[model samples]
Target: MGIWLGALRRPLLRALPTALGVVLLNFALLQLVPGDAVDALVAEAGSATAETTALLRERYGLDQSSWHQLGDYLQHLLHLSLGYSPRYDMPVLDLLLARLPNTLLLMGAALVISLTLGVALGTVMATWARRWPDRLLSSLAFLMYSTPGFWVGLMAIVLFAVQLGWLPSGGDGTVGAELHGWERFTDTLRHAVLPACTLASFFVAVYARLTRAAILEVQTQDYVRTARAKGLHPVRVRLRHILRNALLPVTTVAGTHLGGLLGGAAVTETVFSWSGIGRLTLEAVQAREYRVLLGVLLLSSLLVIVANVLIDLLHARLDPRIRAT
Candidate 1:
């Protein structure tokens, strides 16, 4: 209600300025690139006539001053009218909307797998920290985290798709693979395997380490000591008391990792040719399709903002210390 809104006001206000900054910085960097959209179109058109260049420039409002262009760009951004795409010859937003689900699917599936497996492994390690299994799992996490994304992706493709003949090699579902409703759902999931595992392995490693550390810290706290002294079963004490309290920091870290997983996993998508935001961004870069590139930046920034906000809420709920003004 009003009380929660009051509590959230500061963070919400901070997000506005952060969003504006991201847009401004992203637009400014694009403007600073070596060529303009008009230049790109003209180069591709193969004609250097004055009339044609002038028409092209005017079509995109490039004749305006830098400040004017920036202001206009911001205004369009507010309306979600991200302008036309030079390469695709369609609205930038349209192209992004078309491609967003594929990327989200890949990243989302990977995140779920990584977080689940990671928490399980972490709990086991924390439950038996001094055992050989704990040491072995820790070593494995370290190795997985250190391995490069591309290398792992390539290996998975080689082994799973080519060597074992288990999954498709790359790209979306098979040619014309009924990409709609329930059928496409399963198809996309099937093709998403390599990219997801490539992306998830590193995250699993990081999350396992984080969760293990958090659990270990909670195990040493005074309440945990009291729980042990009481007649409560060890499993119940660990799960309901120690583990729950330890999850606050781990939740915050995992939230941040989730954002990084989506953004940083660009290389994995590119390697797998999964047609996600990462792949879109690469295509935009190669073609100098600045609008699509800007859209990707906006999308990523929004994701990061949303993730941080969710984490803050989760953190506040978990730790009463966050409720203080």
Candidate 2:
């Protein structure tokens, strides 16, 4: 209990400085973007005189020095203010919060599907070893891993939604349908299938390969040999002794892949028209919505850091040897 508590504490303590660094980095990089929200708005409003543009810049404080802007941003951040999105004419944080749940739902579903299916298929392949089933699984994993996510999403929409009319092509739910109870639940899921599967494909391949390798490595260990020699059932030996130990690497890999998953989700979200952070990011980039972009990047970086810290704690729990280190 003490160890577990310590594990949690250490990460929380370390996260503060790391988060501040992310904020600074995101702010600095956002400044490098080619345009600003004022310019975007001005362009959209048609021809603007020099004086009008100057007033617009002054109104938004776009005339301030970069360093001064950073200082103001940091000050506001201390009070949990994410600043306003001039493009959307709202608080940046509110805009993000609105879309956050959708992104989380997509990412959570994809991760669960990938990890569950990958582990199962990988275990089957490892058990079968050099058999045809193993070869087939390996080939599928390779193919999925090599394919691009957006392309897969487009093809899936074309086949499943457009041609077959099996699933809704895009959006969070059925349009104009005041769905209640089960209908509402299923409708969201129905819309999620293509996007989730598309997001999970590459990750499924990753986890499968990792699991296969880890299981094979664990199989050769003396403890596994002992379990087999002690007359344990083959199933018991594989499940209790082999798979448990093999999962450590999979957990680590999953943690490492979280950021990539978010990145891919952006592409997938755009392709599927999902109203998630990824799509928001794409729009922000195009419109040069600096505050929104920075907020998204900072939030994403923080999530990745927190996930890695949790993974480390989980690793410690799974293998006490890590706690000692």
Per-residue lDDT of model 2, residues 161-268, tens digit only: 999999989998988999999999899999999999999999999899899999999999998999999999998998888998899999999998888989999999
Model 1 poorest ten-residue lDDT run: 1-10
Model 2 alpha-carbon drift over 4 Å, by segment: 180-182, 323-325
All models: lDDT?
Answer: 0.82, 0.91
> Whole-model lDDT for model 1 versus the true structure?
0.82
User: What RMSD, rounded to one decimal, does every model reach?
Assistant: 2.2, 1.5
Off by over 4 Å in 1: 1-7, 41-51, 320-325
What TM-score does each of the candidates earn?
0.91, 0.95
Clashes of 2: 0
